[model samples]
Target chain A: MTDHIHDEHCDHEHEAGINWQLVQGWVQTGILIIMGLYFIDLALPGGQLGNYINVDNFGWLTWVGAAIFLSMGIINAADLLRTRPEEHHHDHSHEHDHEHASAGSLSSWIFLGIATIPLIFGLGVPSKPLSADAISGDLSTNVSTINFGTSQSSIDIPSEQRNILDWIKAFSQSSDLREFEGQAVDVIGFVYKDAQLRGTDDFMVVRFTMSCCVADARPFGLVVDFPTGQEFSQDTWIQVKGHIEIRSIDGIDTPVILADSVEVTSQPEQPYLYF
Target chain B: MEFDLTIFATRFLGIFIEATPFLLLGTLASGLIEAFVNKDDIARMVPHNPVLATIMGGMLGFMFPVCECGVVPVTRRLYKKGLPLSTGIAFLLAAPVMNPVVVASTYAAFGAGPVLYGRYIMTALVAIGVGLIFTVQNRPQRILRPQAIFVPITGGSEAVMPAESERMELLPGIKKALLLAHEEFFEMGRYLIFGSLLAAAMGTLALDKEIETLASNPVNSVFVMQASAFILSVCSTVDAFLALAFANTFTTGSILSFLVFGPMVDIKSTMMFLGVFKRRVVFYLIALPFLLTALLSIAINLNIRL
Candidate 1:
C-alpha cells in the first residue's frame, strides 16, 4: 500500500502536472465557442457575414484522417502491450523537457498585423460575382450597371487570338487598352481552348496569366477572322494585335478585338500577363 | 448591432465554405500521416548527402504526405519517434507545397505550366535550404524530446493513469484502429474548427477594398501584398483565384510573392508551427520562405518581357 501511494505521488511529481480534465475542458470550450460561430455564419445569407458549409472539399479528407488516426491508435496500443499493467498504470514518473513550441514572438505578430493592414484596406469588400439581373451590393455594382448594354457587335478574329476576360477587363481599364484600342494594341496572353469555339478560324479565347490574386484580372482577346490560319493550342500565350470591337459572345456582352494579324510570341521575358 | 451581426454572420459563413476543401484536405492528410508512417524508419533514411537527403525528404512527402497546418503536432510526433530535425523540417516545409493533393490542386487551379513546375521546384529547394540550415546549426536534444501521451480523469470518474493490464494485449487490429480513430478525430477536429474560423475572419473582415487599391501600386505593392498573403491564413488551393483577381491591381512581383508566401506561412499554420516546434525554429522557418519569395519575384519581374 505504501509503495502504491509513493508510486502515485512520484508519478504526479514527474511531469504533465496540469490536470487533463482542465486542459480538455479548456480545449473543448474553445472549440465549442468557435463551432457556434461557424453555425451562426451558416445561418446567415450573403457573403457580407460568413459562409459555414465549406466542408465539401474537406469532407473526404476528414474521413481519410479518421482512418489514419485509427491506424495510429492501434499502433500505440501495440507498443503499450508488452508493459506490465502495474508499471503502465498506477504511477510512472514523467519527465518534461520544459521546451515550448513557441507561440510566435511579439514582433512577429506585430509584423503580421502590419502586413495584414493592406489586405484589410486595399480591396473593397468583395461580393459574390454579379448576377444576370445585377445586384449592386456595393458601389462597383453600379459601374457594371451603366451602359453595359449599349454596344453589341461581333468582331470576328482568328481563333488564335482571343484573350481572357480578366485581361480584357484590365486592358479596357488600362491606358493601353483605352488609348490604343484601334492603334493595333499588341498584348501577350494564353489561349483557352473552347471545344465549342474550335474549328472556327476566328477568335481563340486567350487568358492573361497572374501568378496569384485573381480579383483584378481581365480576359480580353483578339477577334481574328483569319482568312487562312493555323490552330493554336489552348493555353498558349501569343502576342497578337487587332482593332477593338465590343460585342456579345454567348449572350454576355464582351469585347472582341479584330486581330489584323497574330504572331506567336516566344515566351516573353515576362511569361504571364499581370493584371 | 443586429444589422452588423447579420452581415458579419453571412460573410463569415461564405468564406468558411471557400476554405473547406483546403482545410479538410490538410487535416485529413495530416491525420493519415500521423497514423501510418513509422518515424524511426523515416529518420534512418536520411543520408550524408545533403542534396539527396533534401530531395528525398521533399519527395518522401508523396508517400507520407502531411499538412503544414498540422505540422507542429506531427513534427512533435516525429521528434518523439526519433526523426532527425533537419529531415523533419524539410518535410514540414516541403510536404505542404509538394504533396500529391496540393500539387493536383495547383495543376487544376493554374493549369500545368512553368509556374506549376516553378512552385514545385522552388518549394523543394527552399525546404531543403532550411533543413540544411538546421542540420548544421542545431542538435536534436536542444530542440525537442520524445513524444509524450497523457491521460486524466475528473470528478473521480476514473483513475488517471496509463493503461497497465491492457497495455500488452494485442487486440484485434480492427479494435485498436477504432480507438485511435476516435482519439484523433476529437483531438484534430477541435483544432481544425479553430483554424478554419480564423482563416475565414482574415478573408472576410480583413481583406477589404482599400487593401486592393493599395495593392494596385506597381512599386511598393508586391511586398505589401505578399506580406498580407503570408498572414491571411488561407489555403493554397483556393488562393489562386483570389490571387488572379489581384493580378490587375498589383505588380507581378507582388502576385508571385503572395502565392509563394501564403502556402508556407499563415496565421493558423504559424500557430500550428509554434505549437509543435520551438518558437525560434518556426520564426526562422517562416522568415526563409518570405525572403526567397521576394528575391524570386524580383527575378521573375526583371526577366519578364510582357
Candidate 2:
C-alpha cells in the first residue's frame, strides 16, 4: 500500500486532464475541515450538541477533537499543495506496473466515502434528543438500588427545587420511602407509560440519565399517579405539580408522585440529566 | 417498532462524536510511533520469552492510555515496527480495559469492589490466554493481512527501503509524522465510522427488551451482556457507567463479562481488527475472547457470589 512512497518516478509530469485523485484528496480535506468546524459548533454552549450527548461530560473532549481534525485537515491541505503530482501519480499506475499502489488508492477512495457518512448525517439530519421512543424495556423506575456515585440528598433541598434525578437520588440514599411522602414536588419530564401501567392512572415522568452520550442513556423517573395521566402522550414534556406518596408498586413500596396538576411543557434546553 | 430517522441520526452522530476523538488520538499516536520509535526499540522492550512478553504486552497499556478506538491503529503501527504477533495481540486485547483511565472510571462507577478487580483480572487472563494461543500457532503470513505483516529492512527486499539511509532529521520527522497522521486518520476513521453506523442502527431496535428478559438467568445473562457489549460498542472509558445502569438487574458475573469482553472486541474494534488481521484471524480474535470471558464469568455466576 505504501509502495508509492519509494517510487523513483514521482517527479514525472502529469497529462493535461482531470486529476481524479487530486479531486478525491481535496474532497477528503474539505470533509475533514467541515468535521472540525462541526465539532467546534457542537462544543459551543446552547448548541444542538446537548441534544445528542450530555455535553457536561464530553464537552472539553469535543474541543480537543476539533483541534485534532483541524490540524489533520491542514496537514492534508499542505500535502495536496506540495506533493500533488507525486501523490496523484500513484493513482494512474495502469500506465506503470504499480498495481498494488493503484489498488491502495482505489480502497482509499472507498474509505474517503465511508469517512463522509458522519458529515452527511451530522449536517443533513436535524438534531433531536432521545425521547420515550428511544427507551426500550430498559427503563428504571426502581432507582433505590442504582448507585449514581455519591448521592446528594434532595430531601434537604426545598421541595419544588428538586428535579427528577435529585428526587431519584434522594430515594436511592434513603431507606424509608415514607419520609418523601407529602414532600411538595414540581418536576418537569417527558411522559413514558410502561405496559403494566397501560390502563392505570399512572405513568412515569422520566428523564434519560446520561453519563456519556445518548448511546449510554438509561431512562429513570418517578411514577406520577394522576387521574388524567392517560391524556399525556408518550414523549410529551410536562410539568407535574404534586406531592410524593409511598405506594405499593409491583411488590415493593415505592415513592409515587400524586399529581394535583399536569401541564404540557416544552422540552428543556438540555433534555438529559447528567449522572 | 417504526423507525425514527431523527432518533437514528441522533444516535449515529452520538456514537460518531464520542468515538472519533479517540480514533484521531490513535492515528496521532500511530504517526508518532512510526516516525520516532524504531523496530529495535520495540524488540528490546518486549521480553524474549513468549509468556512473559504476552504478560508484558497486557501491562503496556499503563505506558499508553488509549481506549479501544485508539488501540487498533497503535497496535497496527507497532506490528509495522516489528512488534511480535503475540505481544501485539495481547496489547490489542488488554490495553483498552487495563489502562489507568478505564481503571479510574470503573472505580468511579463501582468503587473498590469485585467488579473493578474482576474486570481487570478477567481481561488480563483472557488477553494473555489468547496471546498464548497465538504463541503456539504463530504464523504472521496467515494471521495478519499482507500490509500488516512486518517485513524487516534487513531482509534485503528490493521493494523495501533501508531505515538509516532515508531516516529524516527531527523537523522533517515531525512533518512526516503529521502527514502519516493525516493518512491514517482516514484509513482507521472509515472503520470507526462504519462500526458506529451499525451500532447506531442496532440501537434504534428494541433489542434491550429481549436482552433484559434473560437477565435473570445466570447462564443466558452472561451471553446477553456480552452480546450487548458487542453491539453497543460503547467506549471502555465510560462503559463502566453504562454497565452500572444494569448493575441492579444483571448478575455480577455477567456485568464483569461485559466489562472484560466489550473493550476487547466490539462492533467498531472488530471492524478495525478486520483491517489489520486476516478474516479467519479476526474470527478467532472475537471468538477466543468471547468464549474465555463467558466461561470465567459463568463460573463466577454459578459458583461464587460477588
Candidate 3:
C-alpha cells in the first residue's frame, strides 16, 4: 500500500509541480498588462501623454497600442493557465533535446528584471517637462538652421495671430520683420536668457516644439525686453504683451518685443506645441 | 562627472514612450505574417531574377509600410519563407524610410528641400547596393541564426505545410498570431529596454562637446552624425527633427547621412538584429551601412553644395 501511495504522490507532483515556463510566461504577461494599464493611464485625462504628445491627434494610437498589449497579455495568461506541468516537460523541443534551456533559468530571470525595471520606474516617477537645461546643454549657443515640425526646430507659429509657434516660424524665415516691426504682439512662454544676446534685461520667451514626443523637442522663442526694474525668474512662464521692434544682434536682424506688461502666470493647459 | 539623474531618467522615459508602441505594433504585424501568410505563395510571388528581385524588395515597403523595428521581424519571417537573401536584405534596409508615411513626414518637416529627394535616392542606392552584395553569397545557412532559418537550414527539416495553415479558420489563425507575437515581443523587448537606457545615459552625459568639434570637418562631420544616429537610435519616423538641430552647425551631407543611415542600423536595432541574425551577419549589417553611407556622404560633401 505504501508503494502504491508513493506512485500516486509521484503522479500528483508530475501533474501539479510548478511549470517554470508557465511561471515565466505569467510574469511576462503580467508586465504586459501593467504596461497596457500604464499607457491607458497616460492616454486618460490629466495624464502625461499630453505633456509629451498632441493628445488631440495621437491619443487614438495610444489606445490601440494599449489594446494590443492587453489582448496579448490576456492570451498569454490563458495559455499559461491551460498548460499542464507535464506538457511543459513534454513540448516537442524539450522532449527532443533534454538540453533544452527552460525559461526559468537564472539568465531568464535576469532578462525579466532588466525588461521590467524601466516600466516600473517610468510609471513610478513624476513627469517633468523638458526645460532650459536641455537647450543650454547642447553645443555652443550657436544658431541652428530651423526645420519646421522637427524635434530640433524651434517652436514656431507662422500665422499673424498671437500663437507663438507660427510667429517664431515667420520670424525665422524672414530676414527682416520691417513689415510687422511695430505690430502689437501678445505671447506666452517660459523665461530663457541667452547671455550672448544684448543686456541683462533681454530674455527670450520660449516654448519647445515636439514632433513625435519629447525626445524630439526643440526650444523656439522670440527675444523680449522687460523694463530695467523687473526681472523674471528663470523658467517662469509669463504672458507678455508688447510691440515688435527691430534690433540688430550678432549681425542678424532680430525681432525684439518691447513688453508693456509681463504677468507671471501658471503653466499653460498644454505644455508643448505639437507639429 | 556628476550625472544629472533626473535628465537621464526623463530622457529615458521619453524615448521609451516614443518607441514602445511602434515596437508592439511591429511584433503584432510580425505575428500576423507568420500565422496567416502561406510560405509557398510568398516564394512564388518573389521573382527568381536576382537583380529584379532586389529592386522589388527595396520597394516592398510601399506595400507593407512598417517601420525599422517592425521590418526586422517581418524580414526574418520572409527569409524563413524562402525569400531571396538579396531581396530580404534589400527590404530590410529600405523599408523603414522609403515608405509613404515616413516620406510624407520628411516632406512636412523640411518642405521641398534637397533632404527629401536626397533621402529617397540615397536609401534606394544603399539598399540596392547592399542587396547586390548579398546576392553573391546567397546562403542564409551561413548568415542567419537557426531560429531565423525557416527552410531546412540544412535539408532534413520537414517543409512547412501551407495547405494546413490555409485551412485554418481566421479566428483561430489570428489567435495563433497573437500568441506568436507575444512570444516575439518578450524575446525582442529585452534588447530594446537595454538599448534605450544606454541611449538615455548617453543623452545625459553631455557628450556634444565631442560632436561639436567634428561638425566642421567635411568628412569627419559625416562620421560624427552617423555615430550620433547609431548612438541615439531615434526612430526614422522622427529622426529628422533631431537631425534638424544640427543643420546649421553640421553640414547638410552629414544630416542626410544621419537621416538615411539611422533607420537601417542603430544600437537598439542592432540588439534586435541579434534576435534574428548571426553575429557575423549582424557585424556585416552594421559595418556595410556605415561604410557605404560614409563614402556616399563624403562624396556628396565634396561634389554637391550640401
For each candidate in turn, the TM-score is 0.54, 0.90, 0.86
Name the better of 2 and 3 by DockQ.
Answer: 2
lDDT of 1 by residue, B1-306 (tens): 113333333233333333333333444444444445444455566675765676676666676555555454555555544556677777777776667767776666556775577677667767777777777754564554323222222334135532322322334433433333333334334344455445534433134456656765654575786677765555665565555555555666677677667777776577556445556766787888777777666666666553
lDDT of 1 at B102: 74
Candidate 1 lDDT, A1-275, residue by residue in tens: 12222234223432343332223323333333333343333234332221122333433332343344334434444434553323433122232113311113343234334322212322334433211111111211111212111112212333234334333444444433234344344556555433344577654534433322221222334445445444666545566666665445555444455776667775433332432
> Rank by DockQ, descending?
2, 3, 1
How large is the C-alpha RMSD of every model relative to the true structure?
Answer: 14.7, 4.1, 4.9
Interface RMSD of each: 12.1, 3.9, 4.2
DockQ list for all candidates: 0.07, 0.47, 0.34
Off by over 4 Å in 1: A1-50, A54-275, B1-40, B144-219, B304-306
Best-performing candidate as measured by DockQ: 2
What global local distance difference test value does model 2 have? 0.81
Give model 1's docking category: incorrect
**Best candidate, lDDT:** 2
Q: lDDT tens digits, residues A100-175, model 2?
A: 2332256656767787888898889888898888877745446687666533456688878999888887888788
- Encode model 3's per-residue lDDT on A1-275: one tens digit a residue: 01222121123322234454556777889998998998888888877776655566567778877898999999878776675544433112211122223455677788788778767667666676776666654311322244343324333433235566666656555555676688878888888766555456678888877766665666778778877413787788998888888776676566778888888898887777766
Q: Please say which candidate is ahead in lDDT: 1 or 2.
A: 2
